[model samples]
Structures are given as C-alpha cells and as structure tokens.
Target chain A: MTALPDTTGKKLGLVIDLDTCVGCQACATSCKEWNTQGYSAPMTDRDPRGSDPDGPWLNRIHGYEIEPESGHDSRVVHFPRSCLHCETPACVTVCPTGASYKRAEDGIVLINPDTCIGCKLCSWACPYGAREYDVDHGVMKKCTLCVDRIYNENLEPEDRQPACVKACPTGARHFGDLGDPGSAVSQLVLERGGFDLLPEMGYKPTNKYLPPRTKRNTPQAGIEALPKGDGSAMDRLFKLADRLLSGAGN
Target chain B: MNPAYSVIFFTTASGAGYGLLALLGLTGARMGHAPSLLFAILTLIIALGLITAGLLSSTLHLGRPERAWRALSQWRTSWLSREGVAAIVTYPFALAFGLVWSGLVAIPDAVAPLGILTAILALTTVFTTGKIYATLTTIRAWNQPLTVPIYLFFALASGGALHWAISTILGMEPGTVPPVAGFALLMLAMLKLRYWGLIDNAPRDRTMANATGLGEHVRQWEVPHTSTNFVQREMGFVVARRHAQRLRKIFFLLLLLAGGLEGAATSVPAFAVPAALILLIAAWLERWLFFAEGEHVVTLFYGNPNA
Candidate 1:
C-alpha cells in the first residue's frame, strides 16, 4: 500500500449533470480513443472488421424511455457509466492480489495490472461491474479517470482534466478536486440536488448524478386522475387474456 | 461479469476434472490399476493440469496480481477463498493415492482401502469447487442448493466424455469407461432438467426500483452517461428467451445422444469416441450459458435486470 494520507478530507470526485446530458456518446468515444492508445492492450477488440466483433471500452451510454401507461410524453434519459472511483470500493477490498486498491489520497480505485491473475472474482463481487478483463495483458481493466492526463506534469495545467470531461460537447460533466467545497463541481452538486447512483449498493461512488427533472403535468391520485389512452393492439389482447385467465371469460 | 474466458475455462475444466475423479471413485476402482498405473498417472496429470490452468486463468482477470494471496485470507467468509483452500488440500492426498496406485507405497492393507478412499478424496475436490459458486448468497442464481450437485454431475459427464475421446485418439486399451461415461451423461441430463425446473419455479423477482432503490416502482427513464461502465459491460448482457429455449433443447439432445453413444461404444468404440468429443463441446457451451444467463440481483438498479 502506498499509504497516501487520508486525503479523504481533500480527494475530490465528479458530479454529472443528468438534466443537461443529451445522450451523445462523445465521452465514450473519447475515452476509448484515449485509454486504448494510452494504456493497456487497447482494451483490445477481436475481428473489428468481422461480424462477431466486440472490444473493451471503459464507457458506454444506456438509453431509457419512461412513459406513463396512461398519457404522457416518454422521458428519455441517457446515463454514462465508468468506474466511479468510489470512496468505499468493493472491487478494491475483494481483490486478492492487491492488484485492486484505492488511492487514499484521491480515493481513486486502481488495479495494478502486474499482479492481476485475472481470476475475475472481483467482477462478481462488484455490483457495478466496473472491471473489464483485458485479454491482451491477461488482467482486469477499469476507468482510471484519465489518471495519465489528470496528473501529468508534462501537460499544460489547463490540460489536466479527464478525457471524457474534455470531449463532452455538452456541459454535463464536471471534473475537479471534490475536496474543495467551494469548487464549481461541488457547488453544482449542492445546488442541483445531485444524488449517487444506486446509493443502496454502499460503494459510496465518488460521481454523483443530478436527479431527473420532475414533470409539471403529472397528476397525484395514482392511476385514477391520469389521462387515458386508446389501448394498443397488444395491450388490448393482453387485457382480454387477463380477463379470461381471471375466470371472468363469460 | 465480463465473462472472462480464462476464469470460465478454469471453473469448467476443473469441474470436469473433479467430476471424473469422482467417477473414478464411485465405480469401485478403489484399488490400484497395477499394470495401468501409468494410465492413472497420466489421467491424474491431465486432470491436475486442467485444474491449475483454471486457477491461473482466474487470476488473469485481476487488476493487481500480486495481491492474489489475500483472497485465501477470506475463506472463513468467502466461497472463493474456500475453493482455493479445498483445491490445495486435495493435492497431497492425490499424490499419495497416485503412489499407492503405482505400487510405490504400501497401504498397510487396512485403513479404508486406498482405492475407494482415493476416489472419494478426488470427488471431494470437485464437490468443493462446485460449492464455491453455490454458496454465494448475493448472487441468487448461484446460491441455490441444487447448483452444487448439478455442477458435480456435469463435471463428471464432461470429463468422462473427454476422457473417452482422448483415450480413443491415443488408442489406449478400452477400459470399462464408456458405460461409466454413459451413466454420467444420463445423470447430467436429469440434473439439467432439474436445474431448468428449479429456475422456472423460482424465476427472479428483480425490479428496476428494487435494484436501483430510487423508488418503489423504478424504471429506467435515462442513463446518466453515454459511455459503457462496469455495471453495463458485466451485467448488461441478455440472451433472447427464444434463443435460450432453443439452446436448452439442443443441449438436452446433445447430452442424450452422447449418453447413448457411450453406452453403445462398449460394442462400437468408433461411434462412442466421436460422440464423446461432441458431448464435451456441448457441455462447455452449457456451462458458458449457465453463467451468462444467470442474473445478479444488483442489475435491478442499473436496469435490464435478469429474469
């Protein structure tokens, strides 16, 4: 263990602006471009030109559509996921080889690839599944939050930010030293009501997400006061089948 | 969750090895094969080789390899640690048994007869490995009591098929293994049927809200980011129900035919060996699907939870 002081008092994290996020995959693409060339086996892809092609990428966006069964516009939300660099990383604790560890200074979860045996037990123990198996190195991989870029003294001080933060065309991501409460990222979180993803998992993810904006037209009386819609063909079919199954067929 | 092939191979290959070791125990091969001691030693070597390779493969997935020993410290609480310990303990006994089989050492001719005891000990290793997965309470799919027995049976069937195939290729003397392979395959079929039944009767109740804990009836309205993260890459995979159903059918037929071939191979060695090889491949796929299809309860939070 490097035994970096409990920078817990000063080690900062990210706060994602979900409301402003446009579901664009710029961050993912930039992350892949940076990490692949900069670290490990490029999170290698097999048969990139072939039909069964897949590659290891540290970031991805998921699209979700939430619509009322009654009448409402679907709320589409896009979530980008990475390692979170949690304050309490389960992945680090469960790692047998000390290959996985948390930097006490910044609370960044890192895997020392040299000792990684690739047992993948850490993956199972993780609810977030933050670790990816790097086939080329025969070791596990994860997002380092552009560790190479963030702290590189060779780079211009202005360039000392994560690749995803730099590439984000939308101002949805903030990178900063979370240790400073007055930092723009921290203030944004406090003002925006940012919440942790899956707080119940107890990993204490360093990244936070601004909650979805509540719609104004939604009624309060459960299903009764909600606007109605004509049943879709499948919905109509299911309703009839449900009636029959409930023994009210006649 | 990234389905590291190495770990998969380790668990699966070792499972078959342990299963074969178990079969060697159960069939009354309790004593030395004397003249065939070389064959026994070769077989044990192959078995141990596969097991060690598997262990090696699992470590390859770790971000830090040097800290692998820390896993052993958790045997009291972790099934993974127990697996490590169980695997190590079986070796000394196995080496001694090998010596007894080769007539290099005398068994005092009294204590639990080396043959049966060796067989039982080998099977114990397999049982322990299977239990490693079955004992995890956090992953509902793996936590089932049935998982241990199923893994044991499948391991035997898989190893038996592989053993028969290899033997024929090498043109070894036709030992009384085909029938045993057949028996193992039959048991595997029954085990698979039971496993499918168990899952059906208790399909997971994972919900978006329950998983994410954002609300009582949570649904994925949006993902907050645009990049693939740990959760999605590992737990996000899904096999179409229709495709899974088809695979299950194919799996059943493959095992059934392989069993039949093993039984008939006693009279027709040619057919049995090829069928056994095919059976081995099918079992590997079965094992792969078993892990792939299993849903982690944590998926409820990220959405696209398991069935």
Candidate 2:
C-alpha cells in the first residue's frame, strides 16, 4: 500500500505568487487554525506560553532577501512552503506501516493516523520538510489541501478551497486541479513562468511558485537632499546635479 | 538530523551485534567441533543479548511501541520493514546455531548451514539498515555512495573487535583474526574520515535560492514562526565547528588506539577487553557524529542556506 499510485486523475495543488505575497502570516495562521481542529485536531503546541514554545505545523512561511545581481535590484521574497503532493514522494514509499499514502483519485498525500507508528521517517524523507510529527497524537501530520473543506458538499462552492488560499489577503495563494492543462491555476502558472522548488532533487513537486517580477523604471528616492540656500549658487547647483546623477545611476 | 540518543544506541549496538552474529556464523562450525560448550553458550548469549537489547532500544524512539509489530508488514517497498523482517527471520537460524553449538542437539551437518544462513540474514539486515539512510535524497550528507560501505565497515570493525576479546577470554590462540580485526578497524576509521571530508567539501547542491526557486543569492531574512517548531527541532540541529572538530579527533584517536591495542593484544593478550570496550565507545561516538553532522536540505529554508 505504500507504493505510490502509478498515476492519478487529478493533481490538486497550489500555485503561489511571490510578486504579490506581502510576507504576512495570514495563510500560515489560517492553515494552522483550520487543520488544528480538522483532519488532525489539537496540533499540540508544546509550552505554548512558555519560553521555548514549539509544535507541529503543516504550512510554514520563510522570508528571504535576494541580494542585487548585475542588473536586478535587491528584493525581499516571502516563501510559503508545504507538501507539494509530489509525483514521487519518498515519504509515502518509505512508510513501513503503509500509513502514509497518496490518493489515486486526486494525488493528495495523507497519513492515516490510526495506523501510523510515528517513527518520524516520513519527515526525514521529505525534502521540503512538509511532514510534521504530532507528538500529542503520536502521528504524522501534513497539508491535506483542506480535504475536509474541499469535498464538503454542504459548504459554499467558493469557500471550498484550502484555508490558506481562501485566507490569503493579497490573493497570493491559489488552488485547483493541476492535472488539467486548461485549469485556471495551470493557466496562471503558464503565463507567469511558475517553477518548482528544488527541481534538481527530482521529487516532481506539483505546487509551483511564480518568481517575483523584475522592478521597472521607478525613480530612485533617497533621504539625503541638497540643503536649500546653504552655500553659494554654484555649490548648490553642483550638489543638485550630483543628487540627480546618483538617482539616475541607481 | 537530531542525534537522538536512542537511535544512536540502536544503530551502534545493533550494528555491532549483527557483525558479531555474522562472524560467529562463519566460525561456529569450527568452535562446535572443539565442542567448547561454555564458549558457545556465552558468545551466543552475548551476541543475542546485544541484538535484543539494541532492537528493544530502537523501539523507545517509536511513538507507539506497542504497534511496532505492524512495521514489518510493508517490506515490498519500505527498507525499514525489510530490515525488521530480515532481523526476525535470522532469529530462528541463530537459535538453532546456538543450540547445536552448545551441544543441546546433535545435528552435526546443520550447524554450518544454519550459521551461513544466519550470517547472510545478518548482513542483509545491516544492509537494509544502511539503505534506510542511504536512500534518503533529502539529506545530502546521508545520500551518498559511501554511506552503505561506511555502515558495513564500521559494523564489521566493531564485531571483529568484540570477537577478538571473546576469543582471548576463551583461551584460543590469537590467530589471524586479530590482524583482520585491526585491518577492519583501520578501514572503518579511514572511511569515516573520508565521509566527513566528502560532506565538508561537497558543494551546496540545494541552496536557498534553488529551494525557493526564486533566484540565486537568496538569503533568509526571517523564519516563519516566532517559536521553534517540529522541523527546526527534528532537522535543524546544528553542531559547532570547534566541537565537531574536537569530536572527530577523539573518534579517530579512540579507534586508532582500539585497533592498535587489539592487534597487539594477539601477542600480549591482556589488552583485548580494553580494546573491545574502546572500539564500542568509538563506534557510539561515530554514530552520534553521523546524525549530528547530517544537515537536511530543508534547513536551507530556515537560515542555514549554504550547507
């Protein structure tokens, strides 16, 4: 049972926009809140109010400063990471108990808590660090893509997406069937040049991240300016010229 | 790659146990011919005890130890399951070999075959254990061609050291086995040093930029959570360079001393127990370093991008 399905009809995954994400933790928090009481309830927080608080979380955000290159300017990118529901997820195949499995219908990777021994090998197998060991329930937890909400017929169609996608304030997160080439998410990825994280590792992650767009013709602004009438007219003109040259260079 | 003590002990102790078991399987027939009942019983007890204790210690790391039995069911894909099944299968052969050697049964020709079977099973179990880590592409430090050989050689070295100690105590002539043990010890030390060198020198194949797929030169500015989380605790363990260097020196020195003492003990005889004990301690330290030094690629997402 641990052997991954040869293929799935639909690969439900996420497409995140790095250019739009504001580095806010809304997606992560909403994911935590929904999953804490959903598929894997009580995602226990160890010493929540104490000095060294820690717990299991399916989604995590990381902020990175990409230094300036020869032509590109420096920028800050916030990366939200979770299980990509990989095509060849080692985490599923490495499970000794067959508790970790991928759905044949949708390609959604999940863990059956009732059978998991919580050996923590799946977490090690995952290159993205998507799986987390739930010390409280003694099971492995991961992103289900809000399986509970996605399939609940009672919920509104528009509200049935993943909690993180629904809660993204800047519309940075998107979810849909990636298996269909004509899907909205797939079209977005195609138009935006979406890429996989750690493509060289060869997990074949389903999720994609659209890179930040290059900054264009915006005038450089600086705090330091020429003092008004503080020197001779020639000196003031020279200072103004220097400032203009610096701004243009920037 | 947190070096959990329970796992370190499990691998170290189990490797040594399996190594000893394999050696005993190769030599049990000759010893049975000697009909040294005491030696047979004591060695089997020691070997089986180490194996049992190591296996039991491994369960301590499991979240539900009672469900450990379920782990053996998925051998078709899981190396851990294969290891479990192999270990379990070897027990009967080991028990038969022990019983025959101890003169509890008069199965004359069965001893050698059973011993060979046990040896094969032991090696298979050890190989599966090594594969468990070697197959993990996530941790670059562990995913390498050298990992399996390193595991195999260390197990042999430790087993050889223990075999020498037991043979010496049993009044056997210090034969070529001592020199073989010495050679294995040297190989283990060299392989471990080479592994360390390779990991240290290897380029950061999974950089933060590649991990995020954003751009090159991406450096972590902030972590997602304010508090430490499971990924940080499990895969974010970091060892300082100074301490790692010191431990490496100690491990090499201890292994060298063990090998030298064991080789010399063949003539002197008095240094055998000390040599085996030192080798055991060295193996433990080496296993500890093995876990502590492994930097999972996922750590790139946290702040230590240039591993």
Candidate 3:
C-alpha cells in the first residue's frame, strides 16, 4: 500500500492567491477549530494558556517582504503553507507501515492513525513540513483536506468544502479538481500563471500558487476649481442657488 | 536533525555489532585454533549482546513502540523496512556460525559455506541501514554518494578495532588484525573529512524566491506562530559554525590518537583496550555531528531562506 498508484481519478487541490491574502490567519484558525473535533480529533495543545503554547496545525500563514525589480515599491506578501498532495510524494513511499497513503480516488494524501507506528520518517521525507507528530496520540497528523467536511451530506450543499477554503474572507484560497483542464480553478490557474513551490525537488505537487500581481500604475486624484459660468443672469442665479443648497450657509 | 540520542547510539552500536559478526563468520574455519572455547563464546556473546541492545534502543524513539512490528511489512519500498528484515534474517545464520565455531555442533564440513553466508547477510544488514539515511532527498547533507560508503567503512573500522582488542586480551596471535584495523581507521578519518567538505560547499539552490514563488530578494517579515511548533523544534535545530568547527577539531584529535594506538597495540598489548575505547568515542562524536549538522528542506518555511 505504500507503493503509489500509477494514476488517480482526480487531482483535487487548492490554488492560493498571494495578492489577495491578508495574513489574517482565518484559514489557519478555522482549520484548527474544525479539525480539533473532526477526523483527527483531540489535536492536543501542550500549554494552551501558558507562555509556550504549541500544537499540531495543518495550515500556516507566512509573511514575507518582497522587493520588486523596478517601478514598484517593496510590499509584504502573506503566504499560506500546506500539503500539496503531490503526484509522486516520497512521504508515502517512505512509510514503513501502510498507514501513510495517497487516495487513488481523489489524489488526497492521508495518514491512518490506527496503523501508524509514529516513527516520524514520513515527516522527514516531506519537503514542505506538511506532517506533524501528535505527541499525545502517538500518531502522525496532517491536512487531510478536510475530508470529513468536504463530503458530508449532513451540511448544506454550499457548506461542503474544505474548512480553510470556506473560511477565507478574501477568497484567496480556492479548491477544486485541478486535474480537469476545463475546470474553473484550472482556468484561473491558466489566467494567473500559477506555479508550484520547490518545483526543483521534483515531487510534482498538485496544488498551485498564484504570485502577487504587479502594483497598479495610476495617477493620484485631486479636486479642481469649477469653470466660470456663462455670462448670464439665469446661470449666475443657478450657481448661487447650488451653493446655498450645498450646506455652505450652515 | 534534532540529533536524538537513541538513534545515534543505535547506528553506532548496531553497525559495530554487524561488522564484528561478519569478521567472526569469515574466521570460522580457524575457530579451533583459538586460545580457548571460552574466547569464541565470549566474542559471539559480545557481538549478539551489542546487536540486541542496539535494536531495542532504536525502538525507544518511536512514539508507538508497541506497533514496531508493522515496520517490517514494507521492504519493497521503504529502506527502514528493508533494514528490519535484513537484521532479522542475519540472526539465525549468526547463531549457527556460533554453534559451529564453539565445537558444540557436528557441522564441521559446513564451516566454510556457513561462514561466507553469515558474513554476506551481516554486511547486507549494515548496507540497508545506511540506505535509510542516504535515500532521504530532503536532507542534502545525507543525500549524497559518500553517505553509504562512510557508514560502511566506519562499521569496518570500529568493529576491527574491537576484534584486535579482544584477540590480544585472550593471548591469541594478533597477526593481521591490528594492521588491517589501523588501515580501516585511517580510511574512515579521510572519508569523514571529505564528507564534511562536500556538505559545507553544497549549493544553496532551494531559496526563498523559489519557495514562495516571489521575487528574488525576499525576506521574512514575521513567522506564522509566535511560539515554537513541532517543525521548528525538530527540523530547525541549528548549530553555530564556531561550535561545529570546534567539534570537528575534537573529533580529529580523537581519531588520530585512536589510529596511532591501534597500530602500537601490535607491540604492546596494553594499548589495545585504550585504542578501541578512543575509536568508540570518535564514532559517537561523528554520529552526533551527522545529525546535528544536517539541515532539512522544511526549515526553509520557518525563516530559513535557503536549505
């Protein structure tokens, strides 16, 4: 089972937009809030109210300042990091137990806690740090792409999506079958020139990231004086009436 | 990257045990010529004891040690699984080699073939263990051509030193043991130096720009969490350049002293124990450096611009 399947039915993944992300951490917070009680439950925190509070989290937001080549000033870009669910993930093949596996139906990589030995080798094999060891449970925890929520029939049709995607206030995070060329997410990727993180590593990740767009180039707006009215008694009377109605007298 | 003590001890202890086991199996034909029956038994006991203790220590690091048996199921893909299988397969051959050499079993004619088979299996187990680290592409320091060779030679040198010490103590003639072990120690020291050089000069190609798909000059404004997470605590372990250089110097001094003492043990038997002891310390230091200095690619997301 550690050996990956040659082909998958669909490559369901996310496309994150750096330009629109505000680093508000809504996605990360919502991920923790939902997942703590969802599929990988009891996501224990060592010291929640103490100074060194730490726990396992699937989504994390990073902030970086970028200096452009020319014309644009330096700006802060917020980046969200998570598992890409790669086509050839070393993390899957390196698992000694069949606990770590990639779903052939949806191309979603996941860990089976009941069978996991928690040797932590899968964590080392992952370049993106997607796997986190659950110290209390003695098992490995990961994103899972909100498998419990995405396919649940109990919720409303619109509510059936990854927690992070549904929680993104700016609509920076998108989820769909990226393997389909005609899908809306695929079209968005084509329009924005989406790229993969650490493409040189050759994991062939499914998820893509759209780079921050260039700063807009437009002049600042300013107020201008009104042209003199045509020399006419009626025009002058109209101008005086407009000034009185503009709250100038108050 | 955290340099866990359990792993360092496991590799050093088990590697030396396999090395010594292989040597014993090769010399099985001449076991009757040993000083006494007790010598052969003691040597086998030492080898097996080290192996058992090391195997047990390795499981201590696992979060679910009770489920460790599951590790042996994936030899087709995982090197760690392959290592487990190899280690188990070598044990029966090793025990048989012991019985034949101890003059207790009546397989006198099978000595040569059994010796060769046990030796092969022992070396194979060591090779699989080395591949576990060498195959991980996430750590550039461990993912190199020299990683496996260094591990192989260190096992030979450390085990050879122990063999020389034990033979000299038992009043057996130290014919080729001292010289061969000394030479192996020399080769190990040279290989370690080259490995350090290669890792130090490894190119920093995976940078912040490639990580975030941002512009070239990217700097971390702030990390996601204010407190340290599991990734930072485990993979973000960093050793300062000054401290690493100092450790390297200490390792070199220990290795040179151990090598010299191993060579001198041929003339004076008193030098044998000290030489093996020093070599053991040097191997521990080298193993510690191996983990402490390794930088994982995951660190790039935790404010490291390059891996």
Candidate 4:
C-alpha cells in the first residue's frame, strides 16, 4: 500500500502568491485552530506555559529578505510552507506500516493514525518538513487540506476551501485541481510563471509559488522638491544666516 | 539528524550482531572440529541477545511501541518493513544453526545449509538497514553510494572483533581469527574516513532560493516560529566544528587501537576483550557521527539553508 498510485485523477493543490502575502500569520493560525480540532485533533503543546514551548502545526510561515539583484529591488517574502502533496511523495512511500498514504482520488497525502506506529521516518523523508509528530497521541499529524471541511455537505460551496485558504486575508492562497490545465489556479500559474519549490529534489510537488513581482520606479511620497536657485541654496542660506548674526552683533 | 541515542544504539548493536551471525554462518560448518558446545551456545546467545536488545531499544523512540508489529507488514515498498522481515526470517535459520552446532539436534548435514541461509538473511537485513537511510533523498549526507558500504564494513569489522574475542577466550589458536578481524578493521577504517571526506567536500545542492522557489539572493530574516518546532528539533541538529573534530579524532584513535589490539591478540592472547570493547565504542561513535553530522534539506527553511 505504500507503493504510490500511478496517478491521481485530480491533483488538488495550492498556489500561493508571494507578492500578495502580508505575513500576518492568519493562515497559519487558522490552520492550526482548524486542524487542531479536526482530523488531527489536540495538536498539543509540550510546554505551553513554560519557557520553551513546542507543538505540532500543519503550516508555518517564514520571512526572507531578498536582496536587490540586477534590476530588481529588495523585498521581504513571506513563505507559507505545507505539504505539497507531491506526485512522488517520499513521505508516503517510506511509511513502514502503510499508515502514510496519498489519496488516489485527489493526491492529498494523509496519515492513518490507527495504523501509524509513529516511527517518524515519514518526517525524515519529507524535504519540506510537512509532517509533525504528535507526542500526546503518538501519531504523525500533518495538513490534511481540511479534508473534513472540503468534502462536507453541511458547508456552503464557497466555504468548502481549506481553512488556510479561507483564512488568507490577502487572497494569497488558492486551492483547486492543479492537474487540470484549464483551472483558474493553473491559469494563474501560467500567467505568473509560478514555480515549484525544490524542484531539483524532484518530488514533483503539486503546489506552486508565484514569485514576487519586480518593483517599478515611483516618486517618493509626502516630499516636495526645493525651488532651484542660481546662488546655490545651501550656500545662500549660510550667507544670509551669517549677515543676520553680524547685523545683530553690530 | 538529532542523533537520538536509541537509534544509534539500535543500529550499531544490530549491525554488530548481524555481522557476527553472518561470519559464524560462513565459517561454522567448515571448522575441522566442531566448536565446543558451550562456545557455540554462548556465541548464539550473545549474537541473538544483542540483536534482540537493539530491536527493543529501537522501539523506545517510537511513539507507540505496542504497535511496532505493524511495521513488518509493508515490506512491499518500505525498507524498514523489509528490514524487519529480513530480521524475523533470519531468526529461525540462526536458531537452527545454533542447535545443529551444539549437537542438540540429530541432523549433522543440516549445519551447512542452515548456516548459509542464516548468513544470507543477516546480510539482507543489514542491506535493508543501509537502504533505509540511503533511499532518503531528503538527507543529502545519508543518501549516498558510500552509505551502504560503510554500514556493511562497520558491521563486518565490529562483528569480526567480537568473534575474535570469543575465539581468544575459548583458547582457540590466535592465528585463526585475528588476521581476518584485523583486515576487516582496516577496511572499515578506510571506508569510514572516505565517507567523512565525501560528505565534507560534497556540494550542497539544496539552497534557500530553490527551497522557497525564490531568487538566489534570498536570506531568512525570520523563522516560522519564535521557539524551536518539531522540524527544527528533529532535523536541525548542529555540531560545532571543534567538537566534531575532537570526536572524529577520538573515533579514529579508538578504531585504530582496536585494530592494533586485535592484531596483537595473535601474539599476546590477552588483548582480545579490550579490542572488542574498543571496537564497540568506536562503532558507537561512528554511528553517532553518522546521525549528528547529517544535514536534512528541511533545515534550509530555518535560516540554515546553506547547511
């Protein structure tokens, strides 16, 4: 069962826009809130009230300072990392108990807590560090892409997205069938030249990231240019100040 | 990458156990006179005990120790499962070989076949253990061609040292075992040194830019969390250069002294136990370094992208 399926009929995945992400952490927090109570409940904190607090979280946001290079300006990029639901997920195949598996229907990688021995090899196999070991329950927990919400009939069609996508204040996260070339997300990827993270590792990640857009030349705000003077403004001002001081002394 | 002691012990102990089992299987049936029943029984007990202890210790780190049995069911795709299966399968053959060697069983002809079977299974188990780490592309340090040979050679050397110790204790002619063990030790030392060199000089292919799909000049200004997370704890192990160098020197010295002592056992006959003990310690240190120095690609996200 650990052998990956030949193909998933639909590659459901996310497309994130770095240019739009505000790094507010709403997506990460909402993801934690939802998943903590959802499929992988009680993502327990080992020392919630102590000096060194740690816990399982499905999503994490990292901020990077991209230095100016060539013609591009410097910018801070907020990167939200989660499981990419790779077409060839090493995490899934490395599971010794068949506890970790990818859904053949949608390519969403998930861990079956009932079968998991919590050996943690799956976490080591992941290049993105997507899986979190839940110490309290002794199971591996990860982003299920809100499988409970996404497929629930109780939710409205528009509200059926993953919690991270729904909670993104900047509309930075998009979820759809990435396998379909004509999907809106796919089109956005095409237009923005979205790229896969760590493509050289060759997991063939389903998710994509839209790179930050290049900065454009613009005038500074709230500042006015000084009037031109032939005498040179700084020199004239110094001379005027000197004359005033001399007159006062006389 | 955190070099959990439980796993380190598991690998080293099991590696030595399997190596001893393999060597016994290869040589047991061919001896001119059957080894003393006590020697045979004691050898089997030590080898099997180490393997069992190692396996039990490995379960200590698991989140659910009771569910460890399920790990053997996924041999179709998982190297861990394969390792478990190989180990389990080797047990019956190894037990049979022990019985036959001790003359507890009536069939003398069964020794050769059982020994060969046990040897093959032991080698398979070790190979699967090596593959468990080597197949993980996420860890550049472990996912290499050198990993398998290193595992095999270390097992051989440590196991050889144990075998030599037993032979010397039983008052067997020292000429028979020490030479082979000395040779294995030399090979293990060379391979280990080469592996270290390879990892030290290897170019890191995973970078921050590629990891985030950002540009080449990207540098982490802030990590995802203010405190350490699971990923950081599991895969973000860092070793200071000075400490690592010191450990390496110790490891090398211990291994070399073990080899020298084992070789000297042929003349002095008193150095065998010390050699075995030193070899075990050396193997432990080597295994520790294997895990401590390994850099997982996932650590790139935590401002150590270059590591």
TM-scores of chain B alone in all candidate structures, in the order given = 0.86, 0.95, 0.96, 0.96
- How does chain A of every candidate compare to the true chain A by TM-score? 0.80, 0.87, 0.86, 0.87
| lDDT at B195, model 3 | 92
* RMSD vs true structure, all candidates: 13.6, 6.9, 4.3, 5.4
Which 10-residue window of candidate 2 chain B scores lowest in summed lDDT? B26-35
Candidate 2: tens digits of C-alpha lDDT, residues B127-241: 9999999999888889988898888887788887888888888876645457667777888878887888898888876787788876677888888886878898999996787
* Model 2 lDDT per residue over A153-191, tens place: 989999999999999999999999999999999999999
Clash statistics: count for each candidate: 48, 0, 0, 0
Comparing 1 and 4 by TM-score, which wins? 4
Model 2, backbone clash pairs (residues 3+ apart or across chains), number: 0
State the DockQ, from 0 to 1, for candidate 2.
0.61
Per-residue lDDT over A1-250 for candidate 4, one digit per residue giving the tens place of the 0 to 100 score: 7989999999999999999999999999999898888788878888888888888989999999988775556789999999899999999888999999999999999998889998999999998999999999899999898899899899999989999999998999999999999999999999999999889888999999999887784544676787655688887997799899999999
What is the lDDT, from 0 to 100, of the residue A100 in candidate 4? 93
Off by over 4 Å in 4: A69-73, A219-222, A225-250
Q: What is the DockQ of candidate 1?
A: 0.16
lDDT-best of 1 and 2: 2
In candidate 4, the residue pairs with backbone N, CA or C atoms under 3 Å apart (3 or more residues apart, or in different chains) clash, namely none
- Ranked by lDDT, the better of candidates 2 and 4 is 4
Q: Quality of candidate 3's docking, in CAPRI categories? A: medium
Chain A vs. native, model 2, TM-score = 0.87
- Deviation from native of the Cα of residue B201 in model 2, angstroms: 3.1
Per-residue alpha-carbon lDDT of model 1 for B31-133, expressed as tens digits?
A: 3344355666676787678777777776655554566775665454445666776777767766666676555665535223555665566566667667666
